[model samples]
Structures are given as C-alpha cells and as structure tokens.
Target: MSEEPTTPKELSVRSLTGLILSAGLAVVGLFILPVFRSFGLAFRPAFWLVLAIEAVALAGVVISVLTLHRQRTLD
Candidate 1:
C-alpha cells in the first residue's frame, strides 16, 4: 500500500476546511475571552496579545492550506 496521498485534491479541501474551522474557533475565542472575564477568568492585556498571536497562527494555517490547494490544482 502507498503511504503518500493518492487524492491530493480531496486532502487539500479537507485541510482547508479544517484550517478555516480552526481560525473561526480562534476568532470566537478572542471575542469570548472578554466575556469570560466577567466570570473572573482575568482578561489581561497580555491575553489580547496572545489572542493576536493565535490569529496570526491561524492565518498561517489558512495560507498553508491555500498553498496546498493551489499546488494540488496545478497537479
């Protein structure tokens, strides 16, 4: 049996979807953090900074997914 993905297009689509979901969840977390503060979760300025970093990471995942999708399409 081959180890490499035989259907790269499908893989790309799945990866893209996962990345989008991850990014969406991260965005939701960013918004919910403040709300959590009302429950004594402690919404510090550094937390916002961490959220910004998470957003960037999610963006990177999205970029990677797009790149993979494009490469699969070109193939």
Candidate 2:
C-alpha cells in the first residue's frame, strides 16, 4: 500500500505552526537568559554564539514557512 499525499491546506497549517513556535522559543530564550545568569555566563562569548545559532534556526524556520506558503498557493 502507498501513503497518501498531504493536502496543501494541511501542509500550510503545519508549517505555519512550526514557524511560529520556533520564533517564539527564540524570543523567549532571549528574555529568559538574563534572568538565570550565573556568574555572567549568559553574557559571555559562548552564550552569544548559542544565541546566534538560534537566530540562524529562526531564519531557517521563516524560510520554510515562506516555501510552504508558496507551494500551497501554487497548488
């Protein structure tokens, strides 16, 4: 048996949800990091590096959302 393809509506909803969640998490992390700082680790270079990684992840999520929207519209 073969798996059925997902409809554009389903894909758009799922992708949009994922993008929002990812962006939310990144924003929350920015706010929470300063609240739990231990000996200024949150202000250190490594901390900023991790934040940069999260920013990149957020960008990827945004791209994915745009791609899904385009695909859904094309369908």
Best by TM-score: 2
Predictions in order: lDDT: 0.66, 0.68
Per-candidate TM-scores read 0.47, 0.50
Clashing pairs in 1: none
Query: Candidate 2: where is the Cα deviation over 4 Å?
Result: 1-11, 39-42, 70-75
Please state the error at residue 49 of candidate 2 in Å: 5.5
Residue 6 local lDDT, model 2: 77
Q: Compared to the true structure, candidate 1 yields what TM-score?
A: 0.47
Q: What are the runs in model 1 whose C-alpha is more than 4 Å off?
A: 1-11, 45-67, 70-75
Q: Model 2 over residues 1-75: C-alpha lDDT tens digits?
A: 998997654466667777777777777666665554644664676577667758876886877677666444553
